[model samples]
Target chain A: MSVAHWMQYLPIEIYVAWRYMRFNLKQSFIVALAVGIGVSIIIFIPSINLSFFGYFLEKTVESNAHIKVVRELDTEARNRQTLKTLYPDEGRILVSDQSLTRRRDIKAYKNLVSEIMRIDGITTAAPYVSESVIIVRGSQTRTSTMRGILPEAEKNISNIEENIQQGSLDTLSDDQVILGWRLADELGVNVGNRIQLLTNFGKKSLKVSALSNTGIYQQDLSTILVTLDTAQALLNMPNEVTGIGLKVRDMYQAENLARLIARTFDLKTTSWMEDNAVFLDQIRMFRVIIAFISFLIVFAAASSITSILIMVVASKSKDIGILKAMGTPPNAIMRMFLLQAIILSLIGVVAGIGGATFLIELYNATPYSKAETFLGIGRQPVTLNLEYTVYAIFYATLSSILASLIPAWQAGKLDPVEAINQ
Target chain B: MIQTDTILQTIALTKVYEGIQPVYAVRDLDLTIPQGSFMSIIGPSGSGKSTLMNMLGLLDRPSSGSLKYMGEPTETWEEKRRSQFRNEEIGFIFQAHLLLPEFTALENVLIPLQIGRNLSPARIEHAKSLLDRIGLGDRMHHRPPELSGGQNQRVAIARALVNTPSIVFADEPTGALDSTTSRSVYDLMREINREEKVTFVIVTHERELAGKTDRVITLLDGRLQSDEAPKESPS
Candidate 1:
């Protein structure tokens, strides 16, 4: 129902407070305006910072696997751990050795993939074989990393589908390949054309079925996609495939889960979080700084409330006089002023939420540079969050009550005889 | 101790304002007010008439000696007890600033009962009847600023009687009105006094109005000078 109709059911002190504010709308609006500006600042600054951070992080983690399982790092890591135990000396490690570079495959790879899939937080585990090869498009050859994949599992673990600009991954086969758009542009090859793949063991002719632009500089220029069976035959490892790539529920949990996977499955795991530690640390520091600034703004708003309520108490002393003479207790008088503070803050919370939502909508509608996008996606979702908005409301209200306490007490203690004369 | 027939009594009630030199506002004042009596107190300026009225109405405490309400001693009552007494047992009216400016006349009349949080439909009906009796039934919804001075004073009177209190202390109840309004306000109080059997103790400088009550009290320099019938001379 309407506000006036709802007001009739309130207790007497609250009713009196509403009437007092209605009698002095100009003053109440000014105080509410101060609080509203503070609240909007709290919401708007965090939203923008987190939105940009969120977009950048998505781009960093979505273009590649959260965790990559490999064989080379696995044996090296195991030897290092064994040396640490044998030496047991804090100052140095002994018996460390390096092996000649040889292409090694995870044995019983299909069985390992199934085992990795069953682990918690692992959404999917795709076994992929990547080999360095040269593409010969009319004898203009360039080296590229050719990735072989079970198309369905690779699709689940990566943003390859979203990055596809022309043609489709559905057409990819043993003889079909996906080339990065920039690489195709450099080679003067388009979809429906053929490129010769020169691997160590043999040569194969592949049709270009799709082109993608993933917004990652190296990936977009030096990567090609083929079927898993095609790469195994070319590498002459028909019974073996390369390491697995993982998709996880939480990107931040990738590091810890990687440690657990290395210990559980006796394999090495690498997380993207370890690769971009400096950037992530900087974002975390920015978060702390922003939270501190928001607190100061809310504290300033509370100070404004204290001053405003003090002035109101001084102005309304005459009303206090008659109320006391009519047998109203000092506590009731105090409650009247405190209730006004609550109502004022409630108005500010609403106005702040409304103002922040409106401004964020306008910001989201503005176009940003395509280079800053994740997976070349168009819009970033940067708006007021429900959780922090609730916190803002609670803090604003509590501070207002605390700020108005002394003034309300003064109003209550006023002598009826003196107040009336004033 | 107080007599059962008396509504209020004071034994040597005194008030002193302490400073570099003490100034006595009231001293050694013993007074007894009988139930359902219409009386008026008259004195020159600085004669403690207002001070005594304040003590009797529980708005101020006496510095020495005890006051009794309905035979109960009130010397040690806390503010909560005094406020309770003021809300339930007594009423007060002043010359101006009597009603809250924000509330309508009807709501203003409901203040005493509402302050105690004991308002019922019967109390509301009583308030409406009080206003109607004082010729303010039509203006019940109008605020004090919207009404004339006399009309507002009548509303104050309705407010003072809304709780059906045994005694109402009126300090210059008609002090701000003209002679015609003063007469009408005074006449309405006497009518309610006869009909409801409520006691009224009026403080006024107008001897002509003071002469119309059943009893007239005269004070001089914080001392009671005489107690006599309304026929006695204050002129």
Candidate 2:
């Protein structure tokens, strides 16, 4: 049929459906309400899951580099006889073919980065130096993991500058450190304020250069960023970086790239997804359990609709008989009854979606407080998503269609002879 | 021209119900009804009058018979074909009036036309005219339960004629009404028959009603006892 013709046919179908529903007002309302609530819950839960997943991703990315390079650390740094044996005599940093060494000291880090960049789909590689240091602003001092990087090269590997609030990466050259927003707030320091940094080897006073605010509250508040050269000098690890952070073209491709890099380097490399497998699995498992519970709601609503249809079939037996006697076909009679169920379900679904949208909007607008905070922190804002509306409508539509099938079949099977006799 | 005389014809029509012992509700009955005729089938409660009426109305299929309407064989007809035939050519009224209580009087009258015919303004006007003719013009918007028993039956008659069926089957149509109301309903049926020249086959247990018809067929134990023309006209 042409779309126009089908569109024209809709009103008659609706009228027929409306009349059928109007025949039993109470039954229709009950079924519609039950189905509506079922659809609302189904839609609301998925949205919350997606937001929570978003929160989890942000935190994982903040804690680690885009890709961490794993390699063996040198055991003995400074015994001249052992250094000659391990580092090689004829201008080589190391003699092992498994390691990529540079003829010159500067070329060693460059060689490592160049080798990593040669891998297909590897976007950028940069050296990252890290060490645990005490950040002291007067008498108020806190233990923190200080990470240092080459600002320009690190841009490709991390979102350090993007996360900084009060200062830029250029501030690192003036013996300055970028602190997480929470850590800076706790220290009561502003941009250009001086703070003393103490490592195991020595102590140096650095200016508070930036307040970094990433949504990952713990990492945002606790970690500090400094220059890789300065970190190496202060921590007494000269001409050495702790690890190299590498970037891939896609975040999702991290695990695959990590595995390939691990094989090439002959070292253990863990991807972000692998590191946070338990958390993601918990979210997935929770979604499955909640979705199953939502299915029960749909089932209850569908059962109620079925019961209404059954009752309508029973109560309207005489009318059905009259129609049959007037030569109404079994299929037509079935369609009339089935149309009633579809009508009820459609109304319920539409109302549910509308109601759920309103409620979700209200929830998103209103601030929600958690009784116990996440990560030993206080409650934060609730996030609502549009995708939940789509999910709810989709599930409701499927459930309604499924609910009408048995009733339609039963109506079709009614014997006109027996029905009229009753 | 196609012959109009044999509007209805049956050859050895039989309907048997299966049970511990099978019951023969209608047995080997051969009957024919001509166009523009008024006929009544009369019998006691179990004499198979209703079963015969149901078969004639196409509401129930006979177990073994050659039932034909307008010269077309009905034994092998599919559901849609049967429905089309019934929709355009057969009308039925039952004992309980069976007016859908939710619909107004006019809507009830328009049900068959709306279901079967390609409805236009004229068809709707015709329904209104039928309602007005049945003295329900002012009550056209009232629901069946809101109206009296007699008024509800009148709505049923209006619905029956809405499609302009060639024949109407009435199975104890006046069974629920008082005698006075029954007479009035029968009067309306007779008036419509005379005016429209439509055939009517009324199934009733009342002998007085059977006596008033142009002809009567009597059944006893699923067997035809008599088929006689009325000796006198209705008073």
Candidate 3:
């Protein structure tokens, strides 16, 4: 029979690569494990960093509205004239003293709040009255931001129920109020303790309903919560709100939604991201640094693979020569070594992802409180991002393929006459 | 004489080791191997008999020569074509047998067929039959390190014939064996040559072994000294 007949079946290159690994099991294990450690580092760093960012952002967004719409400030308004119209001889002034906007409040804001809530991605639209007031509790007086809200609609936007420690937002009434845990501590008051809120417009006695600690230092320090009727009575603005606080599903879309709200209502809008632009920029810089460091680790691991495979080529040169002498094509020789690299990398990537997940799980499982002091977060969240793991697979596989190129070429170019003698 | 039966014919074949001072490995050599002929090339060390064997086996190209295989000039063949022809028509056994240490005796025997891209069950059975014919059928799964020198050489013989090539070159086929093992290996090659009608070209320094061949060619200092038929054949 012709020896060349029925000549299609298996890929000999993979077989050879697999057998070579089986022959030198220890060396193959060490090289693959090195790649595993590198991949694990790539996966571990960014997941933890992003989790930290997520924790901080959660604390940040809860302290205020994602998008707040208010009357435009005179200093910031594009139209300095506050013109009533283009016709001046009509004797119509844009603003006059009594019945004019004293609070600069969004009038008939209930309709505006409902309108804002109907916009896509806007989860909550709660009208609020904010006033600078002096709190007097047995002569321990401090100036604080007194913010009033309709407790029913308010709890949905800021998720105030989760942060309440001493009492609950459910039982809040027009005569009751909540205080920041730190502010309550400074005034030495407890739930149901009566405190006097004195504003230039009026002074009122209110009962402390709840104390909240949102895991944010500034918000916990100086905030004084009140019912909307109480704040409206203090500010002397009835049936009106200073602003509408809008919440969205995605905080990253807050700025765009803020612009949309501004254009729709002809009012000034502020997004939390715009307010914390510098901090977010710093976080972005941190991510870039993390990614760069991961890249360096990948590059170093790939170099080590090249070094180890070159040693393999040196050790197997005689076998390569034998194959060549038997008329195996040079391309097959290259495939054998490249396939060896791919196999090793796959072993490493699986091991790496598994190891990183275990570590992250262990971290999340631990009961620890130091994260609050260190990162200003109640819990240092360590997230497992499969997206970064995909990147890990790509980086590791490509690195191994590239690392094997030179050594595989060297193996393929072996001189049969010279190598067989060795 | 180059006749119709000629399987390998070379004219003025030259191989030079070029360097600071170029050394002539094989120079101005003309040779022809007839089909189904069992022949030996014998010389002392540095006699270039090994180089001549490598060139004839198509493992190495000569610097200047016209090497014709089955009346086709092979000098201008590309690497892929040359490798294909080598896998299809030529077989080789070195002094050490040179089995891949990772593979079993059976797998080593199947290397040539695998190189030819034939892994069919029938070809595998043919490989097994060659191993059985060489009396190493039971040892087919054993690795090279596990087999004795004579056993390994026999396996090499099976490997060379598994492809059923037109010509096979054995370079010091028994150079590492004891006297008894060498005799057995030599007799096995003679048996295969006669039974399979395949041409055998052997390079060795053993005159006792060379004397049993159908013909003997001697080389000295990169030149062919003589070529003549022996008066007696192997019993």
Predicted structure with the largest TM-score when compared to the true one: 3
Tens-digit lDDT track for model 2 on A1-422? 11122222243334456777876788889988987888777776665666656665765565456677655423223333455776576345444432333211222566677888899888877787777899899889999898878988887566666777766876568387888888988999888798988997999898887788866778877878888877887877776677787777777788999988777765456677787788878877987887788878888888887777778778887777666666667777777766776677778888887766777677667765655546433333445456666666677667776777777677666777687777
What clash pairs does model 2 have? Answer: none
Which candidate gets the maximum lDDT versus the true structure?
A: 3
Per-prediction DockQ comes to 0.44, 0.40, 0.48
Clashes of 2: 0
Clashes of 3: 0
lDDT per residue, candidate 3, B91-144, as tens digits? Answer: 888877588888888888887777777777888889888888888888888999
Compute the interface RMSD for each candidate structure.
2.7, 4.0, 2.9
Expressed as tens digits, the lDDT of each residue in B1-235 for candidate 2 is 1249889999999999999999998899999899888999999999999999878877779999889987777989887887777878888887765887877887777767656744666777888899899999999889998999999999999999998889999988899999999999999999999989788999999988888899899998887889989888562
Could you tell me which 10 consecutive residues in candidate 3 chain A have the lowest summed lDDT?
A94-103
- Tens digits of per-residue lDDT, candidate 1, A299-338, equal 8988888998899899888788778877778898999989
State which candidate, 1 or 3, has the greater TM-score: 3
Evaluate residue B119 in candidate 3 and report its C-alpha lDDT on the 0 to 100 scale: 77
Which 10 residues in a row give candidate 1 chain A its minimum summed lDDT? A1-10
Question: TM-score rank, highest first?
Answer: 3, 1, 2
Looking at model 2 chain B, which ten-residue stretch has the lowest summed lDDT? B113-122
Report the error of model 2 at residue B135, Å.
2.6
Once model 1 is optimally superposed onto the true structure by TM-score, how far is the C-alpha of residue B229 displaced, in angstroms?
Answer: 5.0
Q: Report the C-alpha lDDT of model 1 over B1-235, residue by residue, as the tens digit.
A: 1225899989998888889998888888899999988999999989989888888888888889889998788989988888878888787888866677888888888778777776676777788888888888888888999999999999989888888888998989999999899989999999888887889999988888888888988988888998888765322
